[model samples]
Target: MRGCSRRAGRAARKRRQKCESSIQSVSLGHQLQYVRLRKFLHQRGFTSSLLQPALFTDTGRGLQTLKTIKPCQLIISLPESCLLTTATVLSSYLGQYIKSWKCRLSPLLALCVFLVCERHRGEASDWFPYIDALPTTYTCPAYFADGVLAVLPAGVRRRASEQRRAVRELHSSSRDFFGSLQPVLSQPVEEVFTYEALRWAWCSVNTRSVFMSHPSNNFLSGQDHYALAPFLDLLNHRPDVQVKASFNDATRCYEIRSVSGTVRYQQAFINYGSHDNQRLLLEYGFVAPGNPHSVVYVDADLLCDVLRGDRSLDQKRKFLKENNFVHNLTVSSDGPSWRLMTALRLLSMPQTLYRQWKAVLLGQAVCEEREEWSVHTAVTLCQRLLQDTNAALEKISDLLRQCDPAVREQLDVVQSLRQEERCILGRCLEALRGTVRQPDEALPCQPDDNDDDDAVS
Candidate 1:
């Protein structure tokens, strides 16, 4: 059977009151939608009796076990009819009009269009319950209010602005396509295709969809393929948790297995990748404390800034460009990635030493002699980053002190984001500062200049 997940309805027996909403703030309509969706899934044999979706203080509404569950247990199973695959939408009546979309647009975009139109169809739509259950507000930084954006670190704010721009472009492209279909589309459909509606629908799909291979023999999608699994969306994220999710052809359903088991009353979580909280916030609209993938994004531009206007900096710039060491640097949970630290070390090296290290940078040799100043150089670079981070924090602090109540609520999220990233950078900087240098310790080697290992092996 497909290892599907359904955690909405109460079990057969009367349940404890602890299952009540933690905040008691969930709308009655939302609770009713879940009840209806669960009823529908149960009638269709796609729900489990052992667990139900419940509100948790830390994770909003997620699946919680009502009964003891063992590992590899059949959590829930949904048949082909319930699977929200590309084929599901593409095969719909309106879905046929978009055959050209298959080639012209992404399958994700196709699904987004399907979701928007179907949602506008309301009760006439097949997935009303699921649609109604989705969160009305997304908390990702990209969606942060203007005041919030005004107070954030330039790096994070820049990222958010870029993402927002990209989304706007996506919405525009989709709207143009919708306009082309105007003659064939009904009035309600046309209205729903507006940029605002499509934007909401796209975020709905973007935030909740999961990759599930289409099970039909004719469908040849894989792990990268996506579908909007009903019960699965209710599971909150845990950075360390993993899912063994796939479609089982013989059973004609999609199945899911959590890497870890849940006991009665404990919430079950799925891994949204090892994404640090920053990624979680940006992509998933929520941030987890102490995310494992958390890191300080050390911009390549910062490294370049130091090199600009210095003598022979031209040569160093050429070397950086030739070597591709100038981009994608990060101070991650594991400390500065090998590329960043090593690049900083070489950048710290005195000119003649760097000439010798040119062979090292170009990958022609392995293991350059570690100069006494290498640690000092790396520390200096890290300190520069820290100084920038601190200045950004001070800017935010100044904004918070202004006490504009209207923006303060929104700024809370932005402030937390800044502090979190600052924490990651601070931890990384402190470690880099304290490293007791092994005199003549072998400088970590880049692969041979001719080798491809220079690409972050």
Candidate 2:
């Protein structure tokens, strides 16, 4: 009975996994169709005002209503500096539909509304309910790097500009060799990058380095013991910039050592963009902070300890919860504890996450060191586990053929977890396989009424 139950559960789990995969593919197809229709409208020069799709409630409405009673609206979420470009693009392409956007909202307010509307439009795929009331417009000023924009309160706008200049001065005075380079921000975050212009800015004076970049074109500049390079910049901190770099006088450097690994230095640059334009530019570098003397690497265990105890995870959970998503239970502390971090990464797979949790609690699994591990470690782990389990299943099949009833029963339990690729099951299977013998003094076995059990024997 026990063996039969285990096999039944395994079959059910396999079926569930298969069902989920099918659902995902269907969802993806629906998304693609929606995107196609949206792009078609966009290419046809439908401005935001007139291009807004018919409300989900209005889907059945006739074309006459869409042409006449269809109210036009617009919203923008990016920085005010970005608004001119956005407005120009939409207004120019929209032509006749341009005048319909006269909702009399501020440039800043309009931007935020536009972003919210656009984002929510695709939430339900085909369903689009009317937004009877507009959401409150967020008017806080912000600063933009290549594509990354940092929001700022009205109070910080003035200080932000001053800080940007101060950062530039620090970089200009630095004498370090590699500290002079600047790297571009990674993709997607590049929206903050604009050709050139400074607007409302807040400078984090406490920031360690400076960065410079432009969105339209890839240009990276860092100074003040700060260095930024494109792809290299992605690798935490390792500076590369020759002398004669005008940003700073001397190269800057910082001590980097942590329990987890190297403590990469992160610095921000603040500089004046266009004084008349009222824009402040900030750049981040990973090298040295205010002081650069000699390089030193030490055991950064203390840093790691601080990270594990950090309350940032709680803050992040709150952020996600407020934003409508369920609280993300997984996070990595910037500490020496690889165990939690590793488990969290693996738990990203919803199907096997519960087993991962059990393993973590049991101390059977830990955060595997990946500093030296190749970038493909996660993918490799999944593939290897799959291959190994399949082989184990085949071996178990042979054991059953050999008429090893005890072995077959143990394999039955193992097979359930193996089929689902449950990590904890793998650990459990290995432990059981290593055990020399089952507990002794077995009770007399009960005889089954069915002859099937004896038939197999």
RMSD of each: 8.3, 26.9
Predictions in order: lDDT? 0.63, 0.26
Q: Write the per-residue lDDT of candidate 2 for residues 323-381, one digit (tens) a residue.
A: 33331111111111233333333222222223343443333433222221211222233
The residue pairs found clashing in candidate 1 are 2-255, 3-255, 3-256, 4-76, 4-255, 7-53, 276-294, 363-448, 363-449, 364-449
Model 1 worst lDDT run, 10 consecutive residues:
448-457
| Residue ranges of candidate 2 with Cα displaced over 4 Å | 1-17, 21-457
Cα-based TM-score, every candidate: 0.77, 0.16
